[model samples]
Target: MTRNNYAPYITISREEWAKRSDDPMLHLLNDFETLQGLNEPLTMEEITQIYVPLSRLLNLYVSGAQRLHAATNSFLGSQFLKVPFIIGIAGSVAVGKSTTARVLQRLLSAWPNHPKVDLVTTDGFLYPNKVLEQKGIMNRKGFPESYDIRRLIQFLANVKSAKERVSAPVYSHLEYDILPNELKWIESPDIVIVEGVNVLQVRPRQQQKEPTIFVSDFFDFSIFVDAEMEDLQQWYIDRFKSLRQTAFRNPESYFHRYAHLSDKESEVIATNIWNEINRPNLELNILPTRFRASLILEKGGHHFVQSLKLRRI
Candidate 1:
């Protein structure tokens, strides 16, 4: 996603992209906190350069979709369920996709009922740890196979159809597993932001196989957050170390074993985990899906997005 496109995008510099927003109320975002997530240094400046214009663009898209849906219903002399505008945001581990989702959810929700915004992460749809252990894929947790693809597809379908009450499985980072009998209930919202590493992925089948549906198939727009391989590795290690002192220190946390480790030991373990699991998943699975996204946010040093590549077609 990072500059790895096929000449189909209109590359915009960070300065120029920031200029796209002429809102007099642009100063409101200066105090809004998008600088969230572990080890993610998202300054207010980054928001103005990236998300402000992006959110403005999304507002227009949502408005246009509403108008088009109303026109269709008027022309047919009947009412149709309003389909929600779904935005899928994808990225590698520790790439700050969650922060992006939260920022957009907050910004979009400010308009009240004009567009009720909801945020959901595909992590909730990942199979339980027990299920993964049974499938012998516990080590491949973030890979595509770790997910309950069918259930994720059904959830997205229900959301798009504006189902009265749709619910998704709840995942617990503390437990590192899907919570038993717990769910995240989602009512019909005007816009839904689905964020996860697997959002933009596409799996090609054997030549004789029948065509099938993909999670991205339901997305009206998709974004892929991209960075160099080394940067991602470092970020993952940093986050892991930070979590050890924080979340992993909780006795109920799944990673409690690493809480007491020295900084050197923590770094070593984190590096090993990245090498054995995360790196392979990124190189083999995640990176290949980058070009499939409608927009690509490419970051350089310091985790700041250097430019944006928006698909022209």
Candidate 2:
């Protein structure tokens, strides 16, 4: 795989970016009460200091995209396309991309201009367990090949092409499988957040001929949530231990077998899984795509975003 140069980005410290108040929208973090103390327990200061600015930035992008779409329509003399500004968020397992996405969803929706913001995770795009088993890639679940890329592309295409409604499969974390009977429907949204481990990935040149389309091709903006490999492993193990007593206790859960595991046993198992599956996937597929992001959020020891690098316009 070819590496991308980071020369396009300008690094900004948490303290510095937090002080930016050129936009009036940056002061609206006080209304975002629902996002406080999520599963990761984001601090109030973090919300004000980090994500407020990010929400404003995304709003600007969404507004610009809306204007461009309208201009194109005027030039073509037709109300043709209704493209939702698509935002892609990528990261390794347990790197808090979901938290960033959920926060952004809440914050962005608060803006009156883009009240209809929807978030779709790529986990829902993963092939069903039965299908993965048939393909002999069940062990490779969460890797890029485990996903139904063509279907995902079609779903995005439908959403971007002003389809009245489009549906995507839903994945159950407790069941560790795609719910065969369930689907999440997306209607007309002003902005869409596509969050996943593989959203930014590109097939290696050696793997096949360069495709005419990629999942990232649909994105107007993208973010990569980054942390050290060791930190990610620790976070994964911690979450596993927490889930052992909660989600794993459900008899219907595929991970129910881990319900009885002691903290030590859970730690050992999670660490092993990290080393075997998640680590390799991060190194080979996920991490390599980091520079492809429009912005990179670099997190510290406790999952706090310490700084960010934004691609210069």
Q: Would you list the C-alpha lDDT of every candidate in the order shown?
A: 0.87, 0.87
Task: Report the C-alpha lDDT of model 1 over 244-307, residue by residue, as the tens digit.
Answer: 8899999999999999999999999999999999999988999999999999999985998899
For each candidate, give its TM-score against the true structure: 0.93, 0.91
Candidate 2, residues 1-313: lDDT per residue as tens digits?
9997758999999999888533455455555555542236576677777887898888888888888888999999998857788999999999888888988997798886789989999999999999999999998999989999999999988987888789999999878889999999998888889999999987843657565578999899999999998898888888888888788899988999999998889889999999989999999999999999999999998889899999999
lDDT of 1 at 198: 82
lDDT of model 1 at position 163: 93
Specify the highest-TM-score model's number: 1
Q: What TM-score does prediction 2 earn? A: 0.91
TM-score, predicted candidate 1 vs. hidden true structure: 0.93
lDDT score, candidate 2: 0.87
In angstroms, the error of model 1 at 190 is 0.6
Prediction 1 global C-alpha lDDT: 0.87
The alpha-carbon root-mean-square deviation between model 1 and the true structure, to one decimal in Å, is 3.5
